[model samples]
Target: MTSTDAFNTQGNATAVTDPHTGETRYNRVPQVTWDFWLVKLLAVTVGETAADLINTSLGLGLTNTSLLMSVFLIVALVFQFAQKRYVPVYYWTTVVLVSVVGTLITDNFIDNLGWSFTPVTLSFTAALAATFAVWYMVEKTLSIHSIYTFRREAFYWLAILFTFALGTSAGDQLAEGLGVGFLMSGLMYAAVIAVIAGLFYGGLMNGILAFWLAYIITRPMGASFGDYLSQPVANGGLGLGTIVTSLIFFAAIGATVWYMTRSKDGLEVAQD
Candidate 1:
């Protein structure tokens, strides 16, 4: 039931029926394009900040925060897995939930469990590498363009979880441990992402490599940006507060997803 299979089955179905009727199937993945990244960035950014808002702004604490977000992630993932075709609401909900839950995983390990950021960061990096290793071994390909089966979706979500944890730890190390300010940390990560993009666009790097590198880097970059806007001015932030930042980002994401759904503008259905 991987995205790849879902797409093939749905694409081949002539007259698909809804779930209640047990009719036909439909394609999954939207067409890969610039819009995909735009929405992705928005979703990830919300994930970065929303988690903080729930855990800190609402005073839920790490334990409660993780538990709540984990529940939401599980529910969102269920809907995502149930769908035969790509649905923006389900897809983005899962993404946002994963982002929050992933951040909490890293936070729990680092803050609640007394693990150092260095070890947490390295561990998540290794985990991501291992996931990729296994994914490549089984699938022989890591391209997002062909995610038509459930197995690929499993691999994809596992990799995503690692990215969020890695990003959280890395961002914390840079901003708090290394004494780098929020804005500076964001700029630093942004520069690195820019280099990856340049290498990819200039033909110096492969598409998958560039994509993964950028994907990993965006976590810290977005986290840094989130902290910069949400933290108090005394802490070198604009002091917008997590509530305002989270609300604004969520609204923007909702509007964007709504538009994308209606227009099918960012549809990335796999094709021959």
Candidate 2:
């Protein structure tokens, strides 16, 4: 190439561009450790309780609540994608928003559209599996620790979105549809998670396997907990109202995120 052409290309590279300008532009994932899972569980719980609170307690109803929350999620996701690196606050905010969106997506399918939980659950599961298949094909890995590129980040969020959707459907099926109620369903999933944890700590299972299993189970567990608090007393819940439950969880999430930001506990090298 000519010297002038080379100089022009270098100038373009040095010019200020977008919101992502620093080292944070490159890393897309936080290290997968105990804190990661803990915060994740909190986010899912908040997602369930917060969504229910808005829809019921605030008298927004499912349809309106979904619309409002969906819009917020879109905004949050836009900001999240604009970031070049992993900011704990921004990342977790996106997670919490997506959790609510995921819940609404399933709720719309089952409640508004009059679809059955069985079909919805299976459909979302298939979709998530297909996402993983394609993501693995394109990225050659599904491990969260290695999510450093744009493509991997895309796959990561897509998978998370499906997990929330599938979890909502499954949780609803086992609780209300099957007449299992909220408490029992929560306990059941909690027990299963405990077993997975034991296996992982005992070295009888793989870390990634345990992580993914727990990740999937945490959704139903959180959903059941949310239902137990927000559902009416006649429905075997505390009648606390969805708004109260959601507020409580949202506050908790906010505090946790604040602590994480100051502590920088979950932000580090994600390499295994």
Which candidate has the top score in lDDT? 1
Residue-level lDDT tens digits of model 1 in 1-272: 22232211123323334458765444465644555666666677788788888887789888998998899899988888887678888888887888888888988998899999899999999999999999989987776655657898789889988988888888788778768798998899889978876776676877667777777788888778887888899999999988888888888889888987898764554432
Q: Per-residue alpha-carbon lDDT of model 2 for 22-59, expressed as tens digits?
A: 33223555655555666777788888888777776678
Measured over all alpha carbons after superposition, the RMSD of each candidate to the real structure, in angstroms, is 5.7, 10.0
Q: Number of clashes in every candidate structure?
A: 22, 5
TM-score of 2: 0.84
Tell me the deviation in Å of residue 63 in model 1. Answer: 0.7
| lDDT value for model 1 | 0.77
Number of the top-ranking candidate, with TM-score as the measure: 1
TM-score, cand. 1? 0.87
Candidate 2 local Cα displacement, residue 121, angstroms:
0.9
Instruction: Tell me the whole-model lDDT of each prediction, alpha carbons only.
Output: 0.77, 0.76
